[model samples]
Target: MLPEVNATRYVTPLREGGSLPGIVEADNHGTYVVKFRGAGQGPKALVAEVISGELARRLDLPVPELAVTHLDPIVARAEPDEEVQELIRASAGANLGMDYLPGALGYDPVAHPVEADLASRTLAFDAFVENVDRSWRNPNLLIWHGDLWLIDHGATLYFHHNWPRAGNVAQRAYKWDDHVLRPYATNLATAGPALAAELTPGLLEEVIALVPDEWLAEFDFPSAEQARAAYLGHLRTRAAAWPAWLPGAAA
Candidate 1:
């Protein structure tokens, strides 16, 4: 389970994305970028962040540490903006907090070229999860201490948005021409099997278990366990069909 921390202060809103995440200080004396439960995307987005981020960590990918942040309604009083205040008030409960990376620079492929192997692995991971947000137009990656770190995985596992048809789309191929790392992913043939082999049923379950029950409750699954089972099943199916979905695998 992720460590729980209460919000001690709300700093400012991060205007980079539409969700309106904010910088916050927690009782643990740690600063974080908190993705609110009240955002238009709701708690499901938070669930994807936890599952995908943790899975990346397990795959030896860099990702910020995540925690369950508790927000109190009183924090809304400090905000003068009625719109922001309303968002804060609506998110007066469990939210997702990503450890803030101070001084991290946005990744620019031209300035910081990625290695072929690393790029292939990254593309493979995104393909497996059906993440559609890592395009050049909005690359959700950061560079800290000269190392790449994946962020903002809220757009992943999109199939969950329509559970009834998740199976039909689970095997859909990833469109990678616009991927920020596509040019550097020349070793997908090697990276695909290497990464897919690591995503065992047990490993998938371990990663899914990291998501909070409250977020899982919003889904139609009868229980959190059932929801986890569904996620694992979809991922397993995707992994088995990797040759069809992984970009550059045939090359």
Candidate 2:
């Protein structure tokens, strides 16, 4: 959805991304790993990731820089023609584009040693607010050059499954008692201010405006302006309700 996503940049397929991933060179002069889905993921998934990633970055989380990208088919065909590779390139920007992380390693919460308690708490807040895309098998958290990076947000909010009619009240009630959320909730208050400041009116508007018009139509989320206001409200409430038990809770 970013206006900056260059459609003409030749996206070269990288052989490695498990499935549906094509690594491409971004205009920003950084290597990007992208996962594309022709008709399966739909544009909304990409939209959610872009929006949320930007939002998280604003919240002072360790999310990597990201953008929406279009893959060039000719470049894709240049590869050896593997099924997954072929599919990934064929599905380019229409489905996904990611800014590649250099010197990063995958991480599990239990195994990570740098215990920045506030970072953990903020990430959990993200799960509660966004109905996150992570799980046990694919936590999607990466350790790049000694820093943690969040990825694979394509499944968060599960909007595609619920959008036509978020009719079920249950759908709105994400279980915050899960392993990740339960541990972090205690620290939400201290982390809340930094996160709150990140969701500034300007930042929210800038991100919402990036949503591609095509994706907006397909996903049927609230209108961009309305969606922006709603997201702000959601963050505000989270900030207000942050628990006082966290480290540096006085913040």
Candidate 3:
């Protein structure tokens, strides 16, 4: 579980970020890297980060610790930067934010280890099932202090728009041989029990609420109601159908 840190204390802006990410330092002097709502990518992506990111973590995949941060730009001003001052000022009244990934550098999938391969496949499985936001070029994998870290999950399960009112349950077909998917089918199957354990209705509801109401306008979800229904239904269907061909299916 992540401790609630006051975002005003340690959230400093990254000068190079297109979405204006910040360095989040807690009172215990622990640090994390964060991306905020009013910054670069906007609310929809942030919503995806919290919702999909948390769900993936619950599935026992290798995801960095994440938390929703409430920030005060005035406190953020103390971090000291000529450029970030403008960004912090520009963003106010936004509570939708995430804890940062510390000591991580982005990398290509081929460069990572076999464990990294398993993690990526599990991620792709989650993406395929949910119609996710990750891709080969934009895998969002980070190498932090010698370990692989997964980040930026704002783009998964995009099928809500295609059939918003269709069903409370959706079964979108996925290409098993996708560059990332083919290699990790076995890993995904192995991880199914953990994934199944976490996909409860209560958890899904809480994840959905993490998205601020204002972000609905940016989402392509047909109508707000339909989008919400479809997104939740998609996850449920995916969880129900956890691949059966796993090595130890009887276990």
Candidate 4:
């Protein structure tokens, strides 16, 4: 399970995205960008962040450490902004926290060219998860200490929004023409197979296990276990049929 920490303070709100994530200080003395469960996307977005971000880390990709943050109602009272205070009040529970990158800059493809292999693997991973947020308009890629890092995976695994149809969309093809990394991911043919090999059922189970039970409780699944099984089933099916979804694999 990811380290669980309680929010000690709400530093400030990050207004860039619609979800209204905020910078918070935790009891561990570490600062994090917190994605609230009260956001419009709900707990499912947090689920996608954990699953997709952890999977990226397992694939040797650069992703920040994730933690489960506990928010107390008291934190909301300290916020002066009415809208932000309301958001904090509603999110008085488990939220997703990403390790804050102090000096990171947004990735610019032209200014900082990525190597073909790394780019290919990133593309393949995004495709596998059906992430649609990594477009040129919102790259969602960061550059810290001269290395690339992936962040903001809340938009992934869209199938979960309608669990009943998730299995049917498991084999859906990824449209990569708009992917920010597509221009540099020329080696997808080789990268796809190599990365897919590492995503074993065991590894996936381990990653899915990191999500907290409370986040899974609100779902309509018979139990948290069933919801987890559904995630595993959807991802496993996608992995097995990579040719249908992997960019350049059909060539």
Poorest lDDT segment (10 consecutive residues) of candidate 1: 242-251
Task: Sort every candidate by TM-score, greatest first.
Answer: 4, 1, 2, 3
lDDT string for model 2 (44-154, tens) is 666667777766666666776676666656555555656754575546445456677767777766776545555555554454345554544456778887776767666
RMSD of 2: 5.0
**Which digits, one per residue and each the tens of the lDDT, describe model 4 over residues 47-137?**
9999999999999999999999999969877789999998898999899999999999999989889999999999999998999999999
Of the candidates shown, which would achieve the greatest lDDT relative to the real structure?
Answer: 4
The per-model lDDT (C-alpha) reads: 0.90, 0.56, 0.57, 0.91
- Each model's TM-score, in the order given? 0.96, 0.71, 0.66, 0.98
Q: What overall lDDT, based on C-alpha atoms, would model 1 receive against the true structure?
A: 0.90
- RMSD per prediction, one decimal? 1.2, 5.0, 5.5, 0.9
| TM-score, structure 1 vs. true | 0.96
Query: Model 1, range 180-213, lDDT digits (tens) per residue?
Result: 9988888888887799888888888888989998
Highest-TM-score candidate: 4
Better of 1 and 2 by lDDT: 1
